[model samples]
Target: MTNVYLTARFPRIAFTKLETNGFTVDYYTGRDLISHSKLLRKVAKADFLITTLSTVVDSEIIDAAPNLKLIANFGAGFNNIDTEYAKSKGILVTNTPKVSTNSVCELTIGLMLALSHREVEGDQMMRKDGFPGWSPLYFLGHEIAGKELGIVGLGNIGSELAVKANALGMKASYFKPHQLSEDEEKAQNVTYKPFDELVKTSDFISINAPLTDENHHQFNAEVFDNMKDSAFLINVGRGPIVDEAALLKALKANKIAGAALDVYENEPVFDKKFTKLKNVILTPHIGNATVEARDAMAEIVADNVIWSSKGKEPKYVVNK
Candidate 1:
C-alpha cells in the first residue's frame, strides 16, 4: 500500500476513500495548524503528502520525503506548496479548482454586500443588546443598485461575480492578466478596463485576481489615492496582491470608504487594528468554507492522490 501523510484532517469520507483506494494514511489531527518542524518530520515517510492552504510545503519538506510522488492540496489555491520545486524533484502537485467556483464567488458577493450594507455592524449591534426598532436615521449605507463594480480579475470567481452583479443591477468592469475574448466579456456582462481607471472610478472594487510575481502589491498607496472616497474595496483573492501596509494607511486616512477581505498578507495573522475599524469587514478565509465546497475539495484531493499512486497523471496538475 502507498503510504500517505496527510498534514491535516480533512473530510472523513475522503479519508476513507483514499484508504479504500489502496493507501495507508497517517495524519495530524489537531485543530491547529501543524508546525513546520512537525511537518518536516511527519512528511519524511509519506509517498504522498496531503496539505491544506495553511501548511507550507517548501523545498525542505519535499527533499525530506524521499519517496514522495505527489502533493495533494486540499484547496483550490496551491500557493502554500512550492510547485516549481516539486516539479524539479519530479513530484506532482494538484489542486481542486472548478469545484470552488460557486462557493468562492458566492462569498465574494456576500462580502461585497456585507461591507456595502454594514451587515457586520448590524450583527454586532444585535448581539450586543435587545432588538431596537427600525429608524429612518439608522445605519445609512451604500445602495447596491446602479453601482459601478470594478473587478480586479476575470477568472472563474471574478466572472461569476460579474454575472451576479448584473442581476443585482450593478455595472461590471474587470482587468484581467490577459484580456478575455469579446464573446467571453459579453457572456459575463463585463467590460474590460485598465487597472488605473478601474481603481479610480469604481463604486466598489472586488479583487479576484490570482497572486503572481508581476502583480504583487498591485494595490498600493498611489492606487488607493486614485480611488473615490466613497469607493469600497473587496478582496477575496490572494492577500499579498494588495499591500496591507498601504491598505492600513488608506484606511487610517479614510482614503476609501471601506473594505472587505477574506485573505491576509500573512496567513492566520492579521493586524489587530483591523478589528477596531467599523468600516471594514474581515472574513476568516472562508471563501471555500461552505460544506459543499469542502467535501468536493476532499474528493479531488483523494482522486489526485489515488491516480498519482497508480503512476497515472493526476487531473488538476498545476505545473502543467
Candidate 2:
C-alpha cells in the first residue's frame, strides 16, 4: 500500500482523501514540532511525505527516505524543503501555490491598517486603562487613505495587495527585480518604483517577497534609515527577509513610526523587547491561518500525492 507521512498534524480533510484513495496516512499529533529522530524514522517508511512550512526537509531527511516519491508541502512557501537536492535524487517536490494568496494578502492589509491606526495599542488601552472618554485627540493615529503603499514584491500576493490598496483609496507602488510592462502595470493599477525610492517615499512599506539566497536580510539597517520617519513597515513574507536586530534598534530609536509583522527572522523565537513596544504589533505567523485557506491547501496537498501515486505529474511541482 502507498503510505503518506505528515510531519505535523494538519486538517483531517487530507487524511480522509488519502485514506479514501487506499493510501495509509500517519502524522505527528504533538503541539510542538516533531523531533528529528522521529521524523527520520517515519520518513524512512513513507512513499509520500507531506510537510508544513515549519518542517525542515534537508538533505539528510531526503536521503533517509529511500522510497520517497514526493514531498508535497502544505503551504505556499517551500523554502523549508531543499528542492534542488530532492530533484537530484529523483524525488518530486510540490507546493500549494496560490492557495494562500488571498488569505495572506488580506492579512497584509489588516496589519497595515492595524499598525497605522494603532488598533492593537488601542485595544490594549481599552482593556487595561478603561475608556478615557471619546475625544478627537484620543488616539491620534494616521489614516491609510490617500497614503502611499510600497510593496517589495510583485508576485501573486503582492499584486493582490496592490489591487486591494487602490480600492481602499491608497496609492500602491511596487519594487521588483523585473518591473512589469506598462500594460501590466495599468491592469494592476500599480506603478513601478525603484526599491530605494519606494522605501524613502511611501507611508507604508510591505515586504511580500519570498526568501532566496540573494534576498536574505534584504531589508537591513540602511533600508530602515532611508524610510520616512512617519512611515510604517508591514511584513507578511518570510521572516529572514528583514534583519530583526536592526528592526529592534530602529523601533527603539524611532527610525520609523511603527511596524506590524506576521513573521519574524527567527520564528517561534523573537526579541522580547518587541512585546513591550506600543508601536509594534506582532502576530504568530498566521498569514494563512483562515479556515478556508487551510482547507484549500490540504486539498492541494492530497491532490498532489494522489497524482504521484497514479504515475502522473502534479501541476504544482516546484522543481521541474
Span of 10 residues, lowest total lDDT, candidate 1: 125-134
Residue lDDT tens for model 1, 1-320: 67989888888978899878778889998999999999999988789988997899999989999999999888778888999999999888998888888988888788778888889988888888845688998777878889999999887788888888899999999998788899988877899999998888899998888788888999999999999999999888899998998998899899998999889999699988888888899889999988898998999888888877777899989986
Q: List per-prediction Cα lDDT, in the order shown.
A: 0.88, 0.92
Candidate 2 C-alpha lDDT tens digits along 214-289: 8899989999999999999998999999999999899999999999989988888898999999999999999999
Against the true structure, candidate 2 reaches a TM-score of 0.98
Regions of model 2 farther than 4 Å from truth? none
- Choose the strongest candidate by lDDT: 2
- The C-alpha stretches of model 1 lying farther than 4 A from their native spots are 129-133
- The alpha-carbon root-mean-square deviation between model 2 and the true structure, to one decimal in Å, is 0.9
Every model: Cα RMSD to truth: 1.5, 0.9
